[model samples]
Target: MAHPALKNAWPIPRRIVQRTRGHGQGFITRLMSPADLGQALKPFVFLDIFDADRAMLQAVERSGGMPIHPHSGVATVTVITQGHARYDDPAIGAGEIAYGGVEWMRAGGGVWHGKEMTAGDVSRMQGFQLWLALPPELENGPAESRYIDAGDMPYAWPAHIIVGKYGDVRSPVPAPDGINYLLVTMRPGESWSYAPPAGHSVGWLALAKGMLDAGSTVSAGEMAIFENGEAPISLEATGSEDAVFVLGSAVPHPHPLHLGHYSVHTSAEALAAGERRIAELGQKLKEAGDRQTASGSVPVFR
Candidate 1:
């Protein structure tokens, strides 16, 4: 017998409605939020795909991966597809992640700290950084972080369940119910299908390598937003190269987004609370020297 969540759920075939090319100097990325298309993909707000080579790596190593920053009222999900990277967080400890690895941080109420992630042993790295808006209750809560290596992630052939459930496998990363995220790689001339769970009407995919043919062509450094429906999406590698991409689907986020300089929340009140908490945490970090400790402490917003 199927669980109540899965029972009576059926796959629908979704169609691509919009396509956008990423923008950047070397490692280009498409900023989806603050755009008209952003309203179509709620819960999931911001997206950036960084494609780095040896030159880029050297540049990042020189300046570090963005100075220490602060965030609240949302969770950030980072997935590495090309090479590897390492992260040292006060609350999450330190770990290295290779291809298919993930770094998940929930800045519930507020949090401040950066310089935790750096290029791995490899000379190059490519990956996606995504932001998911938090619900009201969790908007002003405590912050948390997790670094998951590729092997610990569940997979079946070409598909690795990055979040939510797929087949009998479920991701170890904790997240709210009713969302699914997958990292898929199909061999040349190969094909695949994804059937999202019930109520997950919003669907989208961004390719990191190769190409995908879903009636229309989708290539690297591009994203395809699907029309709302329960339809199972069908995709095939169109070129001689394998296709690597990330797919995300979820029930549309219901509340209007209340945005801050570095935060996102469901309501104005929640956003205010989160910003206040961020200010409070900033002061505490300043009082404690706001520097990495000798013993490697895991800092969290209370």
Candidate 2:
């Protein structure tokens, strides 16, 4: 579930007027990528929703799956909604990310992590991993990571401000400016709305579970990119099951996206610099060799 954006042939971006049902790769679904959907929504780039049951979790544990990976020029945000996870970090120490919790890592200059959070004692693990394109200033700066629990997270009614300001609530994460990311849950027949801040013209959300209505039906596993507008995003849970989703808005990124295997930057030179740093870390990671904990899992590397 910690995979990067697929480096497949970049396709001509189809203007997503409203919604899209993205393809699935086993437990993870690729909702948007930097190549297509991301062209219209920058700063807010790639997105994936992962839903794995207990059985799948055990399988991964046995195989030591999801090998360590490198990234730069982007910050990865992982949020859990269904179950929990156990983190074994050398820098931050041990912790747990349960329902509504978040794991944020800014792969500024370069970073290599994937095994930091192993499967926990839960029946299912479900949530999202969003890759936010870093601005010029931070894309090649120092790396940072934060694992915050649900109780400590800032919350407003029906939503958790995952990485930005919401009304009087503001996220603790030092995310770049001009971005607002949120996780929302609504019970059956419940209603909610999101009023974007000025200049935050880019708006979108991927439904995690249950059904929703935003003037149109948005089923589970679907992503909807709202048309450019300043009006509030009116929403409601339509069916018996509760609705949960992650929504984001940002001031459109002004730079042209420069792509790499596990990095994204605003210029070719920046991308090259990030890749070089990743190569250097890959060697160090090799030299460090098998630093897996007694728990039989490896921690993140930078």
Candidate 3:
């Protein structure tokens, strides 16, 4: 009664949690936050889906630049799913982050950044900005960052391993093991299955375009968080257009989240140390006269 590919589906749907849209500073939708679904899907916390079309770009350009900010005790992963984005990081140099490309920054201990990325010349830009909570060890260690081109990332048909291993391929992203993040694209009327690795019970997906039918319908600008289980999940493209989305799964973060003004840590003491380090770094940069730069490149304040 179904296509040949559908017959071998490894995972059936369990449950689907719809996205709760929220306001963003310069984006269309902010899917998850620390209070929303972040607790349920720790290690993978915070997700913002933004559309960088002509109008959005123009608004950003007119508004000038974003201020330098600090983050700690977490790693931020940005993936460009449609069009491209430009970044000039002193640590990783200058490059374009197109589809499948990733910018991973672990704000362990503390660091100041956020003046490096901007919209490229493409007519439209769309992507996901995700934050992962660091483990206790890495959460208080030195900050690190990497800008990996799409070509360097592990490749698989219709799916790019953004965080963890897929099949025999492993992503170059230096992240904690057991977590899996994938960028998947499916053609119209196509069928696909994602068999998550063992112990990865937290599963979720956010679509950028077209429709994905996982028993429940998930359209663009929507995110679907699955129920708690280890069963494989099946996905089908139900729209005429191609389906573009990013899915992530992991064993829930073991530590309790200690929230800060702009950081997340495993404990209160860790948060205090992170905040103190950020303050010291900020002061040092201010005294060195290298805190702000008008160029496109951002100063990596260590």
TM-score of every prediction relative to native: 0.90, 0.93, 0.92
Model 2 whole-model lDDT (C-alpha atoms): 0.88
- Runs of candidate 1 with Cα error greater than 4 angstroms are 1-12, 25-28, 34-36, 293-302
Evaluate residue 9 in candidate 3 and report its C-alpha lDDT on the 0 to 100 scale: 73
* Candidate 1 lDDT for residue 213: 92
Q: Can you rank all candidates by TM-score, best first?
A: 2, 3, 1
Question: Model 1 TM-score?
Answer: 0.90
lDDT of 1: 0.80
* TM-score of model 3 vs. true structure: 0.92
Please give the distance, in angstroms, between residue 64's alpha carbon in candidate 1 and its true position after superposition: 4.0
Best by lDDT: 2
* Per-residue accuracy of model 1 over 1-302 as CA lDDT, tens digit each: 77866765745468899988756655657657634455669888888898888887888667644666789888888898888877665555777887777888889989885656777768778988888887777878888888898989999767888888987889988887777888899988998888888899999999989999987899988899999988889999988788988999999888888888888888888888888888888888778765554433334434
Tens-digit per-residue lDDT, 1-302, candidate 3: 78879877735556775555556666657788777688999988889888877887877777765677899999999999888878776556788889999988889999988766777888898999999999998998988888889988888977989998988999999998889999999999999878888899999999999998888888888888888888877899987899999999898899999999779999999999999999998888788775333445565677
Per-residue alpha-carbon lDDT of model 2 for 1-302, expressed as tens digits? Answer: 43345533422221236688778987989988899898899988899999999999888877877978999999999998789888877778888998678999999999999988887888899999999999999999999999999999988988998998989889998899889999999999998778888888899989989999887888999999988766678888999899999999999999999999889998999999999999999999999977888765577788
lDDT of model 3 at position 60: 77
Q: Number of the top candidate by TM-score?
A: 2
Worst 10 residues of 1 by lDDT: 293-302
